[model samples]
Target: MKKILLLLNICIFILGKEIHAQTNFPYYQDIQEFKKKDSLKFPPKNGILFIGSSTFTKWKDVQAYFPGYSIINRGFGGSTLLDEIRYVPDIVYPYHPRQVIIYCGDNDFAFSDTVTSADVLNRFKILFELIRKEYPAIPVDYISIKYSPSREKLWNKMKSANRLISNYLKTQIHAEYIDIDPVMLDANKKINKSLYLDDMLHMKPEGYRLWEKVIKPYLIKD
Candidate 1:
């Protein structure tokens, strides 16, 4: 009887810890915007859902980029993979998207002093598993971390994470690793300054156009 009681206590403790972790998410305001948008008019089902950090959040013209395709952008600026994992039920599962294109992990390394490429990959694995558990076989496209001029210092770490994720996706049945690194590079194989805005962290129109060209081929037509 005492052993059973101890097991129950352990389970409860773990559950509590998870709940606390989720509740402490820093992007509550950003998530609230999504909720507000849904309350006004629920997004369509089976459309392409894009969720990530600033790169995606600032893409206000995403629909214009992909003509004749239903797309929903749920990106929140400055968010990490952990944020996406916490809010998947709120933002991802409800949409019933035909495909999911995620462009995160940039801020993950930017914000953390000690985070490594392996840590980024593991966080991605957690997010991937969460989606797979609910929607088996649905295509999930992972947009590789772009080689940005502003975050140039972290380029190696970002590249390592992208390579790890790309290799891992090859082993999954319905996963794709979209590498847009080359598209943003110059003839000398360096990050093209022309692709980004003044901040150099986020892409400019030319940059997003490059992305559209690369990603359009992967989109599923109606």
Candidate 2:
């Protein structure tokens, strides 16, 4: 009886630790809000899952952009690839998505100068492998990190990370690297300020419209 009680205590301790860790995590409230919404009425399975950073989270009308396709946007606060990996079970696993679209990694460079391009690439590979492990047949697309006017200095690092990820995806099956940079650039090959909001980091509706044109063809049709 004592042995059984000890085992039960251990299990409870481990569960408590997990809850504590989750609460301490960045954007924990956002994750809980997602759970709250899911509990209310879960999104339909087999939809396109967009999991990433503020770029996607700020896209409140992502579903409207892709009228026919069902989009599940699980993006939270300015999340990095590491954050995405940490919350994979919460965001990626629950849904049986037909396709997964990712847009992250730029924050890693912007947030910390110590984080190299290779670091971002490695983080992406980890996230990709996690998804592929569960859903090998489902198409996984990485939307190349865009050049935000606010993070102009990090553009070189972003470009490097983008190239690395793009090349890696080329070798993997059912993976595509969608480049939206060209469309976002102007005559001088700089990010168009008009597409972004006053902050110059997040996009306006016009930016999303541009993204729609590029991303539409790649989406899987039912």
Candidate 3:
């Protein structure tokens, strides 16, 4: 009887530890909100699904920006590439989106001092593979990391990562690298201050207007 009691205590401890670990995960509440929303009404399958960090999350008018298209935004703020990878099964695959447009990697670099351009590329490749493995032939578009005044120090690293990913995408069918960095730059080849919000990181309405023009051409047609 004592042995049985001891084993039960161990099992309970292990279970509690797992629960604690999950609760402590970054953006756990955001993911749970998504799950709750899903339970209430599943997003339409075969629509364009946008997933990424705060950049995409803050684009609350995404659907309005692209009228006449079926669109679903699953972006969570303060998320990184790894966060998307961890939640892909919950936030991505279930939607069965016809196309996936991603805008990540910004927070990845901001959050880690040790991360490199190659590391970002490898992380993106992992996400690309995960999607392709499940939904072969579905088109995926990765929006290049933008040049922001706030993250000027990491500009070179972000540019290098974009270059690597863009080059790799060229070799894969149904994969596209949307480069909007150039447009975000002024004629002097510097970040246009007018495009960003006061924080100098996130974009303003003007910035998204530029993004819309650049990205619309690549969007899949109905």
Top lDDT hit:
2
lDDT (tens digit, per residue) of candidate 1 on 1-222: 544644453454336436644674578778778888899999889899999998998999999999899999999867898778777877798899999999999888999978888878877887888788889978999999987788889989999999999999999988999999889889998779988889988888889999999999989887
Question: Candidate order by lDDT, highest to lowest?
Answer: 2, 1, 3
TM-score for candidate 1: 0.89
Q: Which ten residues in a row have the lowest lDDT in candidate 1?
A: 5-14
- Collision pairs in model 1: none
- Which is the winner by lDDT between candidate 1 and candidate 2? 2
Which segments of model 2 are wrong by more than 4 Å?
1-22
Model 3 earns a TM-score of 0.88
Give the TM-score of each candidate.
0.89, 0.90, 0.88
Off by over 4 Å in 3: 1-22
Compute the lDDT for candidate 3.
0.85
Over the stretch 1-222, how does candidate 3's per-residue lDDT look in tens digits? 544644453454335435544666677778788889989998878999999999998999999889988889999977988777767776788899899999999788999998888778777877787788889899999999988899989999998999999999999999899999878988898779989888999999889989999989998977
Q: Worst ten-residue run, lDDT, model 3?
A: 5-14
